[model samples]
Target chain A: LNVNINRKRKWDIGKLIYMENVSAEDCIKRWRNEDVDDEEGGDSDSDDSNEEDFFKKKDENSSKESNPKQTIDLEQFVPYFDTFEKLAAKWSSVDLIKNRFIRSAVERK
Target chain B: MSNSKSPLRIFEGHQNFRLRIVLATLSGIPIKLEKIRSNDLNPGLKDYEVSFLRLIETVTNGSTIEISYTGTTLIYRPGIIYGGSYTHQCPNSKPVGYFIEPMLYLAPFSKKKFSLLFKGITASHKDAGIDVLKWGMLPVLEKFGVRECALHTLKRGSPPLGGGEVHLVVDSLIAQPITMHELETPIISSIRGVAYSTRVSPSLVNRMIDGAQKVLKDVGCTVNITADVWRGENSGKSPGWGITLLAEMKKNWCLFSECIGDAGDVPEDIGAKAAYHLLEEISRSTAIGRGQLPLAIVFMVIGKEDIGRLRINKNQIDENFIHLLRDIKKIFGTEVYLKPVNDPESDDFIATVKGVGFTNANKKIA
Candidate 1:
């Protein structure tokens, strides 16, 4: 298959970033469940006739993205939203701030 | 260092806030940015931008970041940069190059020799590619006496399905600021590129090369472009193909451009587009090429307190370049002056600035 996709494949990371009230885990879980449902559907409908339907669902899910919104119109394409959403969900705020430390004992120059 | 005087006050909503943050960290200056995209329909900071700020905070100690409830308005007080082994999961919204681009400026002056592993998109049509750093940035670092620097790609991830990995190891050193006033007239001695295709027909690489060479040949340039092909496991999680061209000049300066293969984009057109971009760069007599303005400025700011000069094409002088120059002046107290260079062949201009005499702020690692 000559898959010429214009859209780069990640999900909307901006929507899932760490916020004060919003839990990163919750965001990840919600997206991951959605992705799980997608995969199950893809597996069950393993026929050439269902390929069109598979792609149609992809376009609908990813059409409302903001980033890379208008750089070059790739036109109706499905990106790897599930992978990115899963990764973002897995990344913890603790992971981002793990090695953060302040050094004491600096001589005045 | 007078503590009595007030720090610089800057208004917000600028896209290049990372540049300001990096400079402030190096200069040890506190900056307060207000109204950060507050007026816009989608107000406040975006995910990748905030992630960049967090990365800066992780790399330094005693640094402070204060953000308002709405994600608009910020106060950043910088501390000494303590560079060491660190890994970051770059947000999928932007490519890894987005993070690595700033590291090119901060890594050499770090407290400890640093090794950074960045995971995410490696290449996108919208962001700088790993190849740009390999061919364009690494050589510029070497010119300033930065030793043992390595930028290597472990995997290739294209935008949207990014899972690419890259390892960059840089040695800590007090920069030897240079005086790059004399530019060896640029002559394209050779053309080299990587035509990368992932999960696609291996023959796509050849078609791209053939199409690109045809364009270069018609222009009467007879240099053969060497091509490297990455396939299967090496090519990241997604399927894509594109070409990145680096034209080596007789002088240390190099000009580079890239074009990724799009859906329905002809392999020949991808190759020809990259070749034409290179030809356009060749026509301009500037020492610094497009997409390298910010880098050229960083080199000048960090070099020994001598004057560094660069010539950029007139059309390339956009608002971002102008604002970056202004922010450099604000943060480092250095001035970047512009003058029109008289070139009949092209509308090129010159910019010159003296270094702030910046040195590593962290205690030497013993």
Candidate 2:
């Protein structure tokens, strides 16, 4: 009788070759920094003016280093990143319970 | 005992309570939980949590659990998992899924074959339903070399007057460490589902299947959904209907989506919603579903000593996920690395971890 092996295969406990490449400390540090970034981003809306000023200074610094034409191009790219950051901030604060994708995935059993 | 040297891991709040217990049990590290819903008008452990603890005690050997008078503080020193045939009546406050979720973590590491008969609400809004476990979770376990497992839904029960029954049988991992290398999301081979209704109109099940098929037809895959209508005795005390959809992908991966009918919910709408949810999951193209990430992480951490890799969507990370990582580090001392997938357009991240190679000490060697 032909049977699907994938449906039948079960193995017992045995040691496999250990391969460790990533450092646990660095991973923890990265996760911590990401958390800090999330907290800051969530509160960024309160300091809107400061953020705008910072962006303006960044644009000015870029303009000083490059030609006038490239500066205009850089200026055009700045708002895209700004909007992306704002979107990220908004995304983080939105309750996952109310999110359509998450609710759909969770509501049923 | 190794438990003597390990300091009790301290935790606060009631978040991820079941997971904390599972980790403590698997790692053999004692834990102290305080301030569990302490500030609430009704403080302390919920009825469902107590029921879960009772079930844990029934399944394990020599476990010690201490709860404060007000139930605000809890100290748990886990015992050896001595899995055997048992029956547990779950609380009505939460569904049987709540209990079964944690049991999945502990059962495979048990000394004997685990056979548990759970009687309670099988489907609810609060937890993944029994169908999800049978179709979705069991397949994931299969990827980790756990094949001798099955979840049979003996009865259909909905909330308020839950009388459902489900039987779970899992054999302990005796020879090989759990290993899975599913990083790339495979194309879906087919779609299968079950639309079940209890103490309700049989027509509702058909409507739900129609709604799901209407949405899934455009995906160019075989969609087969069965309508399961239960009557007296088999149907629980309350009237309810729901749909569970499973997208079976190539390479033995399955993604599940479910929608339970609430008050004034249309069967068609529930079906469409579940189908849309499934489409969203397919689009994300992660190895594991967002809701299954925590369970997958736990399995990865406790797997073989070798490295395991899983692809998960970075956007799925939330407060609970972050806290789980922190708690794992505290209890198991295992940290997992997250590297962005090569595709710039996708939000997927590859999580890499070296397992602790946890084997069942209670299982006798032949």
Candidate 3:
């Protein structure tokens, strides 16, 4: 009466897992939650209330299991979009100045 | 002053040897390579690699290269990229593209403009052909705001006997590259190709074009492929035929794929194979083609201090790309962050990185 317990692994766990189709805000929230989980796991040994700890752990596990998708908020990690906007503004201003100069030169000519 | 910093030590075989040397040169860092193919029976650098080293020495100034007796150990102290008019006769073992690829990286940062003449096999199975560099890589450079460049294939040379010649010219960048933030994969506007034959029957070029068009007709895009038959002196020492296809996308982005005819291969097979390769590249739906990712990434890392963004397919993140990322981080101390694009249908990742602001120290300040 031996039951086969080994499950076939579909993909390599060591390989990088890219979050699929997720927004920036949700990605930040997920990262925050992961940080909180890590902190809690590190201090779990100091907690004396076993029953309460079990229920808290169970809720956290259930919530994580419910949401399988993850996202990355690039703005939070780096100022990429902000930099692009700034550059665009600078470029427009430069173009405006150049255009005015060209118009003046043409009129003088 | 560079000698004050300790030389970077690298081990193992000659994988990414050209890239390592290029990075060292650009960064002005000395590098010592150990155990290059030490375990193998030959246990030394290949003839082509030594030829490439010689080419590097010919192009640069004040560079010191020391190779050990066994050619397994090498110490290279990089100097200023003093690019100017020069001629190099490449060994027949590898095509001219092998040398040209690294030159493309070094050229824009050089003190003087590059007008290089290379004599070797123009088209081969080992590396990108001269046509690919012309139609594929040169246009990609334009995206980085580098426009004054041209590659002219003077003669069509295949492998083995190898009597081909190409002239390459590139203007040095006056300032740092503009930030590249193209994240969207544009729609392909048209497909254009060249089916070239050297010392072969002129009809073979037409057969190759027909074979390519047969595969490309169903794509619903304007397909125009021309035949280029070289004869007499223009045809190289070896007799060969090949096809290079380019898929022109919107916003002037291009994807290139090429296949060369081997000794026993037919022209039709070569053309069809090149077409299929292009189709595969198109299907990847990346802003930069998979083969051009490393080059694009290197350019992005050395761009202006502002962040540059690019869209890359997840499938393109192979082992070599990872190695490139690690090497870039080690040398330039810049890292690229990848964020998944919010599209369920596509596996695209938007890679963003703050450039290191690496300007040419050799350039004179006005």
DockQ of 2: 0.03
| TM value for model 3 | 0.77
Q: lDDT values of the candidates?
A: 0.64, 0.71, 0.71
How does model 2 fare in lDDT? 0.71
Which regions in candidate 1 have their CA more than 4 angstroms from the true location? Answer: A1-109, B1-6, B219-222, B341-347, B363-366
CA shift of A93, model 3, Å: 49
Q: Is candidate 1 or candidate 2 better by TM-score?
A: 2
Q: Model 2 off-target regions past 4 Å?
A: A1-109, B364-366
TM-score of model 3's chain A, to 2 decimals? 0.20
Task: Rate residue A32 of model 2 by lDDT.
Answer: 34
Candidate 2 global Cα RMSD: 14.2
Tens-place lDDT digits, model 2, residues A1-109:
1122211212100100011111222222333342223322232223366754554455455434432221111101001112323433433332321222222222344
Residue B274's lDDT within candidate 3 is: 74
- Give per-residue lDDT, candidate 1, residue B268: 85
TM-scores, each model vs. reference:
0.72, 0.77, 0.77
What tens digits encode model 2's per-residue C-alpha lDDT throughout B1-366? 127578899987786788889999988889999998788899999898899999989888888999999999999998888889999999898888888878888888888889999998988765889999888888777777778889998898999788999999997465434776768866666789999999989999999999888766555456789999999998888889999998887777787888889879878878877776776655544657755677788888888799999887654443345556777878888887766578655556678889987776765445
Prediction 1: B-chain TM-score: 0.91
For all candidates listed, what's the TM-score of chain B alone? 0.91, 0.96, 0.97
Worst 10 residues of 3 chain B by lDDT: B1-10
